[model samples]
Target: MSDPKSLGLLAQFETPADIMHAAMAVRDAGFSKWDVFTPFPIHGMDDAMALPSSKVGFFTFVGGVTGFFSGMGMIWFMNKFDYPLVVGGKPLFTPLFAFPVSYELTILLSAFGTLFGLALLNRLPKLNNPLFSSERFKRATNDKFFVYVETADPKFSAVETRALLATLGASAVEEIHDTEA
Candidate 1:
């Protein structure tokens, strides 16, 4: 078997601008497995990273449509076939009467879709990450910015990646290894 492989190399930056520039360079260098961490959301980072648009809206739309149709079907089955009811000679299945319940189900299922879609898409509930092992990385949530390029990338080379990060003005560069590896 081969030796354990590295997870990636992490470079710390003093400011958002520094991290942003590093991300662009990494992207342009044809590195697909890289990420940037910031204390808070940074505007234009999406464009710099070349990330794709989220598909959560598609999930919500599907959920809403399913809810509306199911609501209509349920009302029709109950009133028209299961047990026909005549109150003051009203129609068995009236769209006017069904509107309220249909609207409610549409909102409810759409919400469920949005919640579950986000969780699944983001791979949520991840209790741990290797990056958390670094004491310096803890500052990422407070004030520091970071850019990391994984060794799994096609263009990754430990020495060359470190050199590139240094050239981009990284304050500190550190290699991260996978504990399980």
Candidate 2:
């Protein structure tokens, strides 16, 4: 039988401070495939992890622009070209008349953009994770903090990374293996 594959190493921390420090160290060490888990959000964890700004805003902007133009174009085609009509001595097509519909469409599409953008960016619907295999990791949602370093990272050295986590005050450093075929 084939041996289980090494997924990564899971390091447990006793407090928010310990995990925060470990995150910074892991970030500074240049390990890319790593993550931190805590019972609740940490105030400065983003800065500590050195994460980049989210692209979800960009997606929302694009969706809004597309919706607005599409809405306006549809009204223009229906009023000005398809069946032009002069009412109350006013022009067949006018921005003032289309403004409300366009605005509504813009808001609708922007919401959809934000939802889909977040899902795509986060790699959602991830039904499973190697970390879930660790019984101790369950406490992450209750009262524990954890730093997980994936073996896929180029900077991940089994011995060195384990020692680094230990030095960073990790109470327990356990290896995570992928048992699935």
Candidate 3:
């Protein structure tokens, strides 16, 4: 018997090639809700997996633009409109003075956006995971490659999925116990 809380079923692959092959197989077989884990990214895996273009770049773009505008606004407010003061006989709104702080703030905000956006997009900050308790999952960060078909997926069926994995050269298959949220 498997745990009822299982979120997905994991199938292990011995090599990166096997995982990539399985990715293709899964996509062609119309299993869209599957994820593959590897020690490192394999080239062309996304195509095989049929993954869509990521919006991470968009997040970065927004963050950068927001940072730039925010920097410009702050500088303008303090130096020009809000509290204009001539310093060293220079214009109240000196682009040179603004450039340094604006540049620095832009870089800083973009960096923060990258980190925070990635986490938010990935739904991370995961304090706990059932996979951690599973003896089999520990190898994910090490040498082995694995694929999982989430139960939330409409196409998920343990028996059929296991067979599909086996046909794709899965070395081993196991159930994941998804706990209560």
Candidate 4:
């Protein structure tokens, strides 16, 4: 009977400069529940938005742990478990041989962990979102940036939000809806 709750507003910008200004304006206005989308990352934008760096280091740590164990296991399997070999009179627990593959696996696993972890943490792979409905939002993949504030935020109100965006010099602002949430 009533328009579904709004996801937020989508303000599209034609250039990084406009987006940069928008970010600063949003930050200065003290709006924490917002994000910027750009064709490519722009330097200083993160600082402008005051976004903290992600805790991907924790993911890397998990990956490194996996890699270390896997590497050690492979060596143990080949040297001790399955095939015991005496090469050049070297001991079976030779760290030298294991180091290369082990190191490689460490880097590999850490990288995979970072990728998977980020995706999981961000809840990505979101192929469709209400932002897709805004005609101007298509430029995000080419040369546009956007900032959205969810209605769930305490500061959100159609009239007040529009007023804030206008004060922030948002080029164009339009409401976006996400019925399914």
How would you encode candidate 1's per-residue C-alpha lDDT over 32-98 as one tens digit per residue?
9899999999999988999998899988998899888889899999998899988789899978889
| Residue-level lDDT tens digits of model 2 in 71-147 | 99999999899999888998888899999999999999998989889999999979798788899999999999999
In model 4, the worst 10-residue window by lDDT is 1-10
Ten contiguous residues with the weakest lDDT in model 3 = 1-10
TM for candidate 3 is 0.90
Candidate 3 lDDT at 49 equals: 89
Candidate 3 residue-wise lDDT at 90: 82
Q: Flag clash pairs in model 4.
A: none
RMSD of 4: 2.1
Task: Give the candidates in order of lDDT, highest first.
Answer: 2, 1, 4, 3
TM-score to true structure, per model: 0.89, 0.88, 0.90, 0.88
Model 4: residues >4 Å from true position, as ranges?
179-181
Which pairs of residues clash in candidate 3, taking residues 3 or more apart in a chain or in different chains? 5-178, 6-177, 6-178, 7-178
Looking at candidate 2, what is the lDDT of residue 132? 85
Query: Which candidate number maximizes lDDT?
Result: 2
Q: Which ranges of candidate 1 are over 4 A from the true structure?
A: 1-4
Off by over 4 Å in 2: 85-90
Cα error, residue 83 of model 3, in Å, equals 2.9
> In candidate 2, residue 83 scores what lDDT?
94
Compute the lDDT of residue 66 as modeled in candidate 3: 80
Candidate 4, residues 100-127: lDDT per residue as tens digits?
A: 8899999999999999889988889998
Model 3 global lDDT (CA atoms, 0 to 1): 0.82
